[model samples]
Target: MSKQRTTQPITTGTSVIGLVYDGGVMIAADTLLSYGSMAKSFNTPRLYNIEDRILLGASGEYSDLQEIVAKVKALALQETTNSMESIYVDRKLPAKSLWNYLRAVMYQKRSKMNPYWNDVVVAGWDDQADKPFLGTVDKLGTTLQENLVATGFGGYLAMPLLREKWRSDLSEGEARALLEDAMKVLFYRDCRASARIQLAKCTSDGCIVSEPYELDHSNGWNAPSMIRAAGDLDGDGGW
Candidate 1:
């Protein structure tokens, strides 16, 4: 008898988020790679800096994610080489162009009935146009541009927090705080999430991706003082 094939992702990274701020865009993702219900890696980054003004964040199958990253790097090289050789000075890859390219890739895979099984967020700033953009594309090829977006459990756990905290006039500092808060919420709720995260930004000046850093989790559930000062537990059975 013939067996059926599974199209769902087997090993995956959980939760990635992206947001657009006043003059830039920022994205964050955890470093946990899970194999089914098992923890695989604790230091695998899911965020990538594509160029000086473009960042890509993905949450899904790690192998598929790597393939996308490789494809993007190859495309960048091809575009750069073509720009250097062509007479036209502006025939280069822009953030939107890269985003469109990824969209096409996912769409093609979906059409073939074998999708990449990833939810990708693209954040970029166009210096010439002086505009910032944030968008996401899923394995099914669905694309959306929003003030804030998240994948996997992040969408359920952090999206509400982002929706409430996000503002059009938010400064970079304020945006960073909001992003961190959202990440903390995810870390607290997602079993596959960790306090260690990678953060990246795309601005008019350039892109900056930070090294993996652990978030401050002091005074959390692990703290020893679990009871309120007003409520005495020692003589709880007085009645």
Candidate 2:
């Protein structure tokens, strides 16, 4: 017999992807919120920018994501207040430090058997090291520090494509193009995904999250007639 469930996620988001390139890190996610299998909302932004230095992309229960972000923002604000009292402390938190904090929070929740139900990618540039940073933390507080990371179906569908083409020396344009291609594949296959996506980057200057933009998949691959013809052929077994 199946065990009874007390609660389940209602609104959800799919697939958040991130990678480090030559000078910094980039992350992207589709603007879609799903209720069960239905696409409940569009134009939802999953990427969050913190203090113009860090980029956060999350995929999972929407409410859970909001809760985590709100808590983090509060923590950052508190840290900022404390920074004014200390001449040595930086005004903002470091990316790795923030990531670690999230890991701790997620773990605490997991220990209580009430996890956040989200997988989050954190990206930023290190001023001291003069380099880019990329990492991820999940609902169970599992932390992964990697040049590339993703959540949800993106792990299965987009990761292979990212791994095959990613290079440490990739320029910003190249990295964006690669991410767009991977997102296109996801939009084609992941029913819960959307063609509208937002891209964010962390560089020496700062982090910037773009407005939601439509993904271009106009390669005749998803033409309505083509899909209809393929379905008809499959139904008739002409081959």
Candidate 3:
């Protein structure tokens, strides 16, 4: 008789954003990880720095991703000598190479009949050419994407807005501003998303993860304009 396998429902997150510009790549993720209808937790660190130059932003199975991050970091440390010259070498693994490495790791897990249930965005500057790079890896170990990518529930709502504003020619400043706008829209509209976000910029210099900040809600674009219009119908400016 074949052994029975128990299946567990996946616990995951929502709304991760990845973009590349002239200077480097930027990735943003909300801190909420939802388990079905329940908003299970907050303050989850979904964005991870793999080694020095590469970053991995994930949107599922918090525990599994955490394990993956730990293993990758350990492997990176093991692969490098502790000498100053080796540490200073600019010829280490690039974002694309890291992506390939992760694909293999994820695939190995899947082949074991137990997989990490998360979609991931891998972003950084390519160590060789020193250019921005971005890619997406799904729970099934499929890796693909370019320019911009998003994962989780908010992905459906957020990616279209990003693609509308994203340009290959955009400078770092423009990309940051556009991403801020996109996050605001997602926060207001995405039920599973949080108003708080963590942003990271990865360049040839290195990865810089910002302090968490709240999405600006003061920009009244999403406020009830119709209600304001109705109040104005009386011409008194009172509602």
Best by TM-score: 2
Query: Each model's C-alpha lDDT?
Result: 0.85, 0.89, 0.78
Clashing pairs in 2: none
Tell me the deviation in Å of residue 39 in model 2.
Answer: 1.1
- Model 3 segments beyond 4 Å from truth? 1-10, 82-91, 219-239
lDDT of 1 by residue, 37-119 (tens): 99888998888887575798899888889999999988988888888886766565678788788889999988978789899
What value of lDDT does candidate 3 attain over all alpha carbons?
0.78
**Which ten contiguous residues of candidate 2 have the minimum total lDDT?**
222-231
Clashing pairs in 1: none
Q: Model 3, range 5-58, lDDT digits (tens) per residue?
A: 325545667778888887888988988878886888777768877766788888
Compose the digit string of candidate 2's lDDT tens values, residues 1-239: 96543266789999999889988899999999999998899989999998888888899999989988898888888889999998897778888889999999999988877788889898898877889889999988999999999899999999999999999999999999999999988998899999999999999999999999998777748565445544466645354
Model 1 residue 20 lDDT score: 87
Arrange candidates by lDDT, highest first: which order?
2, 1, 3
Q: Which candidate is the best by lDDT?
A: 2
